[model samples]
Target chain A: MSNFPPAGVFLVGALLLPLVPRRVRAVALLMPPVASLVLLWILEPGQTLTVPFLDFQLLLTRVDRLSLAFGYVFVIVTFLGGVYGLHLKDVGQQVAALLYSGSALGVVFAGDLFTLFVFWEVMAVASVYLIWARGTKRSRQAGYRYLFVHMAGGSLLLAGALIHYNATGSLLFEPMKGGLGATLILVSFAINAAIPPLHAWLPDAYPQGTVTGSVFLSAFTTKAAVYALARGFAGWEVLVWAGTAMAVYGVVYAVLENDIRGILAYHIVSQVGYMVAGVGLGTEVAINGTTAHAFTHILYKGLLFMGAGTVLYATGRSKLTELGGLWRALPLALGLYMVGAFSISGFPLFSGFVSKSMTVYAAEVDHRGLVVLLLNLASVGTFLHTGLKLPYFTWFGPSRPAAPQTRVPWNMYAGMGLAAAINIAIGLYPGLLYELLPFPVDYRPYTFAHVSETLQLLLFTGLGFWLLIKMLKGEPIITLDTDWFYRRPARLVYVIAVVYPSHLFATTERIALRLVQSLVSASRDPIAALNAATVTLFGRYPDGRMPRRRHNTGDYDPDRYRLPVGVMGLVILALFVALMLWILLAR
Target chain B: MKSTWLVLVVVTLVLTVSGDILTRKGEYGQWWYPVPGFFALLGLLGCMAIVVVSKLLGRYWLQRREDYYGDSGAGE
Candidate 1:
C-alpha cells in the first residue's frame, strides 16, 4: 500500500468506472479521493514510490508540506466535483474528470521532471474530453483549439525538460537556474497559468465546456500551473510584473464580458495572477501566501463555477443578457454563489479577506508598492464584476422574458454548499488553512483595521457599481481579444493557402485538359482541324464577324492523366531515397 | 431599490465615522487611519478607474459584434 502512489487510486478507479453499474460509479468516484486523502495523511514526507526507467529513476510520490497542501485541496475538490457531477450519466465525462484530477495529483506528487511531464500531458488530454463532452458544435471546435494550444505548450515543456536533463545530467525536478531550459520551462508553465497572450484560450474554451465539466476544468489546469511555478520558479522577478499585468488584464476583460462563465474565466486569470505574484515575490511568507491562496481559490472558484453551471443548467443559457429575475427562482444558488463571490472579492469576513490579503501584505512588507497597488485595483475590479455586477445582472437585473427553467439537481447544491462551508470556515478561522502551509504562519487577517479597510473598499466599490449601473449593463455583443489574431487570420490564411489553391488548381487543370484534347484531336484530322484552329486563332468563325465559341462540357477524365504504376513506384522510391539521404547527411 | 441605496449611504457614513478609532497595522499604520473614509475613497476611485479604462478599451478596440467570427463560429 505504501508503494502505491495516491494518484494511482484515482487513475485505477477511473478505469474501473466503465465496468461498474451506473449507481455504483458515483460511490466509486468518491472513494478514491477520500482514500487518497487518508493515504496522504498516513504517508510521511519525501519520495515514497520510485521506479527504474530506461536511464533515470521515476519518482512518483514525493510527500512534503507543499505537495501535501496541494494534495489535500486537490482531493477535496475532486470529492466535491464528484458530488456535483453525480447526476451526470455520461460515463466519458465522469472518467475524464477522474483522470484529469488524478493527473493533476500526479503532477503535484511527481518528484522528477519526467514524471511531471507525463502526468502533465495526461491532464491536458483528459480535460479536453470534458470540453468535448458538452457535445455542441462550438464546444467541439473549442476543444480542438484547446487541444492545439496545450499540444504546443506540452511540446515546449518536453523540449525544456530534455534540454535541462541534457545540460545537468539529472532528471530531478528542482529549482531551475536561469538559462534557455529554465526560460522554456517557465514559458510552458506561464501558458498553462493563462498569463496573457496565452490566456485567451481559458476564456475561449472554458465557457464553451459542459456545465459540470467546466467546474472540473476550472479547478485543475491553472492551479496545477501555479503549483509547478511555486515549486520551480519562485523568486523569478519577471513573474512579478508579468503577474501584475495578468491580474489587471484578466479583470478588465471580465468587466467587459457578458457570459457568466466567461466573466468567471477571466476572473480565474485575475485570481491566478495573485498567486503568481505571490510566487514571484519569493519570500517564505509570500510562497506560503501563494499556496494558501491556491488552497482557498480552489474551493471558492470551484463554487463560483458551480454557481454559473447551476445557472446554465437551469436556463439552457449562460449569457447575462438572456438571464435576469432569477433571484426568486434560485435563491439558494444565489446565496451559495455569493459566499464564493464575497470570498473572491475579499469581503471582510470571508476567505478572500484572509487568503488574498496575505499576498497583498507580503507585497507590502517587501515594499512592492506597484504590485500592491495593482493587486488592490484588481480587487476593486473583482468586486465590480464578480462580487457585484455578475450577481446583479444574472439574478436581479431588469426582468427579461422568463426562460424555461429546469429543476437543478440537488447534488449540485450539495457540492456548492460543501464548498461554501469550507470557504467561510477558512475565512472565519484561517488558522485551519494556515497551519497546513509550508512556512510558519504569523499573519493576522481579522484586525479591526483590516476589516474596516476591506469593508470600506468593498462597500464603496458597491457604491460605484450603483452609480454606474447603466454603464455596466451587459450588451449582447462579443468582446474581441488576443484570440482574434489567430482565430480569424488563421482561417483566412487557411482559405488562401488550402482552399483557394485547391480550387484554382482544379480550374487550371480543367483548362489545361481542354487545350491538350484540342491539340490531340487536331493532330488526328489535320486538314479540318487546321481550318477550325485557324478560325478560332484568327477570331474569325463560320459566322460573319466572330461567332462565340461554345464551351465544352469538359468531361475531364483525371484517371487518364494518372502516372503509370511503375513510374509512380519509381517516383516514390526516389522520394524515399532523397528523404533518407537528407536524414543521413544532416546527422 | 431606493431603500437599498438609502441604507448603503447610511452604512457608508457609519463606517466612515467609526474608521477613525480602529487599531491600524501593516502598511501606513495609524498615520493614514485617522483620515475619514480613506479606504472608501480609494475603493470608489479605484472602481471608477477600472470602469473608465475598461470602457475605453472596449470602445476603441475590444468590443465587437456578437457574430464577429461569422460562419466559423470560432470566437464562440
Candidate 2:
C-alpha cells in the first residue's frame, strides 16, 4: 500500500474487468473507482510514491489537496459513469472506461512531467475508445481526429518535459520557469483545456461518444488540463486573457449548437475557461476557485451530459431539431436534467452558485474590471444555453417527441440521482467543498448581495431567452469553430497526399487497360500485335491510325472473355516497362 | 410554473429595492455595486448582445450543413 499508487486499483481492475464475466463485469466496473476513492481518502498529503527507473525517480503519486480534490472527483464520476453504463455488454468499452478513469487518476497524482506524460497519453488513448464505442461512422471519424489532436498534445508535453529536464536537470512537476520548455508545456495544457482552436476536438468528439462514455469524458480530460495549468503555469497573465476568450468563445458556440451533447460540450469549454482564468489570477482565492469549480463542475457537468445522453438513449436521436416535447414522456430524465441545468445556471442552493461565483469574485478581487464584465456576460450565456434554450427546445419546444427506443436503465437513474444529490449537498453546505480547496480563503457564497446578484443575472438572462426563443430554436446546422481550420483543410491535405496518387494510378490503369486489350487479342493472333509493335517508336501503320484486325483475333472476344482488372493493369504495366527498355537498348 | 416565476420576480424586486438593508453598504469592487438592478441590466443586455452577435456570426460565417464535412469522412 505504501508503494502502490491509487491509480493501480483502476489499472489492475481494467486488466481483470474482461475476466469478471459479462454478467457481472458491468457490475464489477464499479470496484476500481470505489477502491480508488478509499485509497485517495486514506492517502495522506505529502505522501509520495516513486519508482526509480533509468536513473530517474518517477513520482507516480504526489498526494496534495489539489491532486486529492481531482482524484476524488475523477473516481466519483467513474463510479457514477460505471453505474450509468451498467447495462453494457461490451467488455472492450468497460475495460476502456476503467483504464481511462485510472489513467486520469494517474495524471492527477503524477509528481513528475515524465509520469504525467505517460498517463496523459494513456488518458488520451483510453478515452478515445469511448467515442469509438458508439460504433457509428461519425464516431469512428471523430475518434480519429480526437486521437490525432491529443497525440499532438502529448508530443508537445513530452518535448517540453525533455527540454525542461535538459534545461533545469530536474523533472519535478512544479511551477515552470520562463523558457521554450515551459511555454511548450503551457501550450500542451492549453490544448487539453480546449483553449479555442485546439478546442474543437473536444466538442466534436464528446458528442459522438457513447451515452455512458461521455459522462466520464465530461469529467476528466479538460479538468486534468486545468489541474496541469494550475500546477505549471499559474500567475501567467496570458492565461487571464486566453481563458476569458475561451469562456466567451464556448458559450457563443453553445448558443448555436444543434446537438444536445454538443451544446453541453461547448459549455465545458466555457466552464473550464473560468478555471483557466482562476489559475492565471494565481491568488489563494483564485486557485481555490479553480479547484472548487473543477470539483463541483465534474458533478454537475457529468449530470448534464447524463441527462443529454439519457435523451439520446431513449429517443435514439441527439439533435435539437429532431427532438422535443419529451418532458412528459421522460419525466425522470427531465427532473434530473433540470437539477443539473439549475446547478449550472448558478441558481442559489446549487453547486455552480457556490463555485462559479468564486472565480468571478476572484476577478473582482484582483481589480480585473474587464475580466469581471466578460465573465459575468458568459454567465448570462451559460444560463441562456444550458439552462433555458437547450431544455426548452428539447423538452417543450415545437417538435413532437420522438418515441423512446429503449427504457432508460435503473442504473442510469442511480448514477444521475447520486450526482444530483451531491450537487445539492455541496450547494447547501459549500463548506464541504471549501474544505477541499488547496488554499484558505475567507469567502462566503450566500451573502444577500451575492445571492441576489447571481439570481438577477440568471433570471434576466432567462427573460432574454424567452424573448429570443424563436431565434434560439435550433436549426439542423453545426456552427464552425477553430477546428474548421484543420477539419476543412484536412480535405485538401488528403487530396494531395492520397487522392492525387490514386488518380494518377487510375490514369495509368486506363492506359494499361487498352494495352491489355490489345495483348489479350494478340493471344489468338500473335502476328498482328508483333506487326503493330514493330511499327512503334514513332512508327505508324500505312492505314493512318493502326492496323485494325479485330475479326482475326478469333479466340479472344472483349465481350466473351474477361480478365480481372487488377491482373490486366499489372501485365500492361510490365509490358510497357519492358518495351521502353528494349527501345532504349535498340537506340 | 407561472406562480413560481412570479414569486421569483417579486423576490428579486424586493431584494433589489431593499439592497441597503439586506447587504453591506460599501463598494464590493466595481462602480455598479451601488446601483440596484445593475447586474440585472447586465444580464439582460449581455444576453441580448450574445444571442444577436453569436447568431449573426454563426449564420454568416460559422453555420454549415451537417454533411459539410461529407459522409465519406472528407475522403478519409
Candidate 3:
C-alpha cells in the first residue's frame, strides 16, 4: 500500500500482457525500466525494515554504490532490449523479459536472504518462458532442461537457507564460514553461474531462444547469480579455480562452435568467470572489478546478442558457416558488433580493458599464480573466438550464397548504438564506473605501465593465434561438450527407463486381452442356455424366482446360482485375499 | 570422443592417487599440500593428450556439416 510499487507489478504485467493487443503491449513494456528507476531514486541508502508476522520481510531497497551501478546498467539494458525486440510477434516474450529483469534487480537490492530467494525463484520461472517462446521443438526441450536445472538449484538454495537458519538463528544474508550448508548455497549459485562440470545449461538453452529472447536471456540469470556470489561469498578462495576453469573451458568450446548464438552462450560462462575469480580474490579492488566487469559485460554482451539477433531477424540464420559477407549489407550491425567484440576482448580503451584489469591486478598483487595464468590464457582464447573469429567469419569472411543481403532496421541500430556508446564511455572514463562500485575505489586502471603490459599480453596472444593457425593442423568441426552427456546418454537412459516398464505393461495387457477374449467366447453358449432355462422355470412361479429343485444327490438346492449375493460375496472375498497377498509381496 | 574419455579416466585416476597422498588434517585451517600438484600436472598433460588425439582422429570422423542436429530438424 506504500507509494513504492510492489514486485507484483512485474508478475501482473507478465500475466496481463498477452491479453492486451500487440501494439499496446510494446508501449506498456516501458513500465519496468521506469518503475525500476523511480524505485532507485526514491529508496535511501542503508535502509532496512522487517514486517512482523512474516518469515520473509521486505528489504525495501538499498542504493549503495555497487547496487546502484548494477541497477542502472540493468535498467538501461532492459530499455535497449525493449527497443531491440519491438518487432517481436509474441507479447509473452516482451512481458517475461521485463518481469525477469526487474526481479533480478530486486534481488540485487534485497538486504536479506529471504527476500533475495523470493526474487531469485521469480527470475528463474519468469525468464524461462523466453526460451520456450522460441516455438522450436529443440527450444522446448531445452526449456525443459533449463527448468529442471534451475528448479534443482532453487531447491538447493531453499534447503541451504533452512540449514543456515538453523545454524545461525538468523535470516540475514551475511558471509558464512564454509560448511555443508554454505557449500550447498555456493553450489547453487555455481550451477546458475554455469560453473564447470555443471555448466551445460547455458549453451543448452540460450542458443535455442528467439533472436531477441536470447538478448534478454543473456543479461539476467548467470549475472544475478554472480551478484549473489559476490554478496555472499566474496572472499572464498575456491571460486578462483572454479572461475578460471570456466574461463578456459568456455573459450576452448567457443573456438570450435559454428553456431553464432552458441558461441555467445558459451562466452556468457567465460565472461562471468572473470567476475567469479574476482570475487574469490576477496579484496576491495577485486570486488570493484567484479561489479565493474559485470556492468560492462552486460552492455557488451547485450550488444553482441543484438548483433546476432539482427542477423537472425533479417536473414533467419545464426550459424557462422551459413552466414558470411553480411558487412556489405548490414554495415551498422557489423560496426556495432565490432564495438562489443573489442569491449569483450579487453582491448585498450574499451569497457573490458577498464574493468578486467582490476581483477588481473588483484590476482597479481595477491600472488595467485596459477589462477592468473589460466585467466591470461583464457583472455587469448576469448580474443580468438569472440573478438576476432565471430566478426571475421560472420561479417568479413567469404560470402555465402545463402547469406542475407538486406539492411537491418533503425531500431536495431539504436539498441546496439546505445550499448556501444556505454561500452566506450566506460572504457574512456573508468572512474564513472568506479564511483558506483559497492565499495570506495582507490585503484587506478590507466597507468602507463598497466596499459603497456595489457597491450603486450594481448599482442603476444594474437601472435600465438596466428602461429597456431599457420602451424597446427586442427579440425574445424564443433567439439562436443558435457551437454552431450545428458542430451545423448542421459536422454537414452530416460527413454529406456520410461519405455521399458511401459513395454512390459503392454505385453501383460496383450496377454490379459487374449485371456478375456477366450473366456468370453467359451461362456457365450452356456450363458444363453442358462438364460433359456431360467426363463422357462421362472415362468412357472408366481414370483420371478424359480422354486428350489433338489440336486441329483437330493441334498443341495439348485437355486443358489440365481442368488447373486452368494456369488458376489465369494468373489469379493477372493479379491481381498489376493490384494492382501500382493501388498505383502510388495512390502 | 574415445580420446576425451581416455584423458578423463587417466586424470581422475591420477587425482585419486595423489589426493590420497597429499590431503591431510590441519589444526587451524584446512591444509592441502603439493601432492595434488602431481595430479594437476597429470591433468595438464591429459589436456594435451586430448587436444592431440582429437586433432588426429577428427581428420577421419569429423566432417563439417550444414545441419548439426543431423536430422531434417531436431525432435523436441
Clashing pairs in 2: none
How do all the candidates rank in terms of TM-score, highest first?
2, 1, 3
Candidate 1 chain A minimal-lDDT segment of 10 residues: A549-558
State fnat for each of the candidate structures. Answer: 0.63, 0.64, 0.07
Instruction: Score each candidate by Cα lDDT.
Output: 0.87, 0.88, 0.74
Ranking by lDDT: 2, 1, 3
True contacts kept of 3: 0.07
lDDT (tens digit, per residue) of candidate 2 on A122-149: 9999999999988888899999999999
Clashes of 2: 0
CA shift at A365, candidate 2, in angstroms?
Answer: 1.2
Say which prediction, candidate 1 or candidate 3, comes out ahead on lDDT: 1
Interface RMSD, in order shown: 2.8, 3.2, 11.9
Give the distance in Å from residue A410's predicted Cα in candidate 1 to where it truly belongs: 1.2
Candidate 2 Cα outliers beyond 4 Å, as residue runs: A503-587, B1-24, B72-76
Best-matching candidate per DockQ? 1
Query: Model 2 TM-score?
Result: 0.88
